[model samples]
Target: MNTVDALVQLSFQVQRILAEAGAEHDLSIVQLRLLGILRDRQPGMLELGQHLGLDKSSITGLVSRAEKRGLVERSPSPHDGRGVLVALTPAGRRLVEVGEAQINRRITELTKRLNATQRKQFTQLASVLVNT
Candidate 1:
């Protein structure tokens, strides 16, 4: 297979793993992404929307649903009174941790076809692509 084709197939395989892991916790891929983003930084709605590639209304709806599920909360931004930041709740953090473990396990399984050296090289190459 060509490099593009191989990369596309690998993307699908990884996405499938992520979907399966997120499904175990009743999260859609987008929701999982939201929680994952919140696991580190608390961003205002505008920034969050940009990160998620969502518009204002769409982001609002997503946040609302997560809030209802006790997974995320909105707080007044310390820097901007008019702006609200979305953050992961304790429940959200716990869910992200569990879901991450499952995803890691599944992804490790997928990489088992590679030898240890190949796996290390692949990780380095993939990181370059991601970071670039």
Candidate 2:
């Protein structure tokens, strides 16, 4: 019907798909996002917060939880002594690889449900929404 309603429905569907797929990886969406961000290298807490649009407090809490689960670790930054670095462990990297595969599978399933024209339109609409 309306734009908001359509968006709400899409969000619900996306969340449901992600939740179902991500359950096997045992990661929250936020944690998954962080892993995606860290796929290449480690980042400091401030950089992570900025990238995630979260505050220092939120990042600290996430890092704390992740550390407790042995998913991540905090180390002294090679660039700066005062800054701390966040890096994924071997188990964390394995989890991320599995999660990425699962998430991609779910996304492919969602896309397959759309016709080519509808998929194109959805892509354009999503790009516009993100830019706005």
Highest TM-score scorer: 1
- Please, what is the whole-model Cα lDDT of each candidate in the order they appear? 0.93, 0.86
**Each prediction's number of clashing residue pairs:** 0, 0
Prediction 1 TM-score vs. true: 0.95
Error of 1 at 49 (Å): 1.1
Runs in model 2 deviating more than 4 A are none
Candidate 2 per-residue lDDT, tens place, 7-54, comes to: 899899888877776666677878777888888889999999998989
In the order shown, what is each candidate's alpha-carbon RMSD? 1.0, 2.3
Best model per lDDT? 1
Candidate 2 weakest ten by summed lDDT: 18-27
Question: How far does residue 111 in candidate 2 sit from its true spot (Å)?
Answer: 1.7
